[model samples]
Target: MLSIRAVICTLTCLLFSGLALAQATPRAPGLTFLYSLNCTLGASLPVGAGPNGNRVVIPITGGSFKGPRLSGKVLPLGADWGLIDSKNTFSADTRYQLQTDDNAHIFISTSGPAQSDGFIHLRIKFETGSSKYYWLNNVIAVGILTSGNGYVAIDAWQLTSPTKA
Candidate 1:
């Protein structure tokens, strides 16, 4: 009877251990909507097939962005030097400048791969000298790109921890 009780206790402990492990699993980071950028594009300047892939430079004419935190206009002086690999996988590499409605300048850089959903997923980084927008310099941002005739639209989001600091 003592041996049976011991076995039962061991099984209970194992089951509880599994439950504890499940409960302790880390949670995924949350996303906070950052901004939406809609920028007009000029003609695609094909660079032909390079050593890496087919390169193309698409000119950014101008655009606007808005969000809960900030609103801005994309300066008309940027380009997307995107590439298409042999497997036809598109990778986006872009650099742009933004001027906030309040007149602060922010430089933006983004790079990522095109997804199966016909949208490019971007890892965005920002640089700015304005103290008001300095937080953008440390932001972990992402964006989804959807391009249409003469333009591209990106909906950006920032990753946030579940707990407030």
Candidate 2:
């Protein structure tokens, strides 16, 4: 009877330990589907070499975007201040304005690195005073940028906690 009780106690402890380990495991957060924007970039004007790299200015001519929550036109008058280091990595800092179809104004800025593969990954942020779209002012956004001919396209996604969905 003593031996049998010892075996039963060991099995119970092992089972509980397995359960505890399972419960302590970490979970990864899920990405929610957010909005996307496409932008057009104008010609890149070389600004000579700086201490860090070669400086350049790329104009943000104009573009339009249609997303689930918002659709608008990208206004002109914005430019991308970029630098290309010796490693050939292009870092771009772009600031622009957006005008929604309803006349709401939004300011946007994105900065990121572009490799030789021609893909630019960016961290984007927004500022707006419109009550209808104020949620954009406080969210984290990621974007993938691509260029073709005389245009640049950016697809943006907003990150959200899985629990919040």
Best-performing candidate as measured by TM-score: 1
lDDT of 1 by residue, 55-91 (tens): 9999999999999989989999989999999999999
- Where does candidate 2 have its weakest 10-residue lDDT segment? 24-33
RMSD of each: 4.3, 5.6
lDDT of 2 by residue, 29-92 (tens): 5555455666677778999899989999999888898788888899987999989889978998
lDDT of each: 0.95, 0.85
Error of 2 at 50 (Å): 1.5
Give the RMSD in angstroms, all C-alphas superposed, for model 2. 5.6
Q: What is the alpha-carbon lDDT of model 1 when measured against the actual structure?
A: 0.95
Q: List the residue pairs that clash in candidate 2.
A: none
